[model samples]
Target: MRTVREANRWAAVTGALLLVALASSGCVALLVGGAAAAGAGTVAYVRGELQSTLDAPFDRAWTATVRALGDLGMPVTAQEKDGLSGRITARAAGDRKVTVQLRKVSGTATEVRIRVGTWGDEGASRQILEQIQHRL
Candidate 1:
């Protein structure tokens, strides 16, 4: 019984320290779950990026993202794409860097991630995502 108590205490301390380390490293996560079931999307914000699973194919999603950037008047600095993944780098107003990454999740789903600036601007990221979704 004493040994068991000691092990439990050590585990609790280790878990708390891990959480503290992650928090101090500027790693934060917010999960907005259950949207997929409602035919919308599943979204998460983590580590200065907004991630979402869109109900669209990778090709369609990639096209929508490119068009969205153009529609928003953010000049595309760079774009790279293959069959499985794609990335778009753009310059927002004031030259703030924006990045959009996409991966093929399934035949009917694509994963999208967006980050604005260095640390991240959640509002701006969300707006970009909304624009992409609008095109999709």
Candidate 2:
């Protein structure tokens, strides 16, 4: 396990680097960063942080994410699609056109993979999924 001091130091360094990257490249850098973080999934969340949050029941995490995103602006969209597993989708009420998706992970009905986007919700589904996965 990483010590508190070590974690704090790394966080500070990360924050500084991120600020520079964002200032130079805009929020896409942040999206990429978040996706990178979320990519670790159930493994080491980072170099040392254990990803215990993802261990919760899929519904619990999905609910929490929906709530969190709702609080942030996105609201649930579609609940189902023909010939496919059910999906929990949402969108922002604002002009930005942000859409969010929570789909069941393969071979499981209880777990979900989340994705978000905008502009009629077309194309770039993977980026949305990566965005949610990286952030969470």
Candidate 3:
């Protein structure tokens, strides 16, 4: 009887230790996951592709995108639009290419993505996106 009691107590202690180990590992996983997400956002910001969702219809957003390009003096080299989506490609001085993509998210919402140059110029892309938002 005494030995059985000792064995039961040992088993309970071992189970508790296992649970604690699992809980601590979960915390580590959460920290790593959060760091990964932050790193991805930083990389995107550094890459110079600016994205925004605007409260505007697709046609209106498309028009604003074109106007923004022109306002920045980036001549539109190519453009196409349909009921659901549109894209405008342009070139600025120094042959920097700019692309603006507009996607209809809903009847009154659009997602705009802008990238400047092949390697992406953060300042230029941000300026263009802000211009489009202002026009919208």
Which candidate leads in TM-score?
1
Please give, for residues 3-112, the per-residue lDDT of candidate 1 as tens digits: 99999999999999988876777553311144343343877788999989899999999999999999999999999999999999999998999999999988898899
* lDDT agreement of model 3 with the native: 0.79
What residue runs in model 2 are displaced by over 4 Å at the alpha carbon?
1-53, 81-85, 93-112, 118-136
TM-scores for all candidates: the values are 0.72, 0.34, 0.66
Worst 10 residues of 3 by lDDT: 37-46
lDDT minimum window of 10 residues, candidate 1: 29-38
Q: CA lDDT of 20 in candidate 2?
A: 86
Pitting candidate 1 against candidate 2, the one with the higher lDDT is 1
Tens-digit lDDT string for candidate 3 (1-136)? 9999999999999999987886787965556654653331222244567766777888988998899889999999998888899889999889988888888878877877788888787888878877887898
Per-model tally of clashing residue pairs: 0, 4, 0
Query: Which candidate do you rate higher for TM-score, 1 or 2?
Result: 1
Top candidate (lDDT): 1
lDDT by candidate, in order shown: 0.88, 0.47, 0.79
Candidate 3 stretches with Cα past 4 Å from truth are 1-48
User: What is the RMSD of candidate 1?
Assistant: 6.2
- What lDDT score goes with residue 113 in model 3? 78
- Native-to-model Cα distance after best TM-score fit, residue 130 in candidate 3, in Å: 1.2
Cα lDDT tens digits, model 2, 22-66, are: 778768655766565443243222222122224334554465555
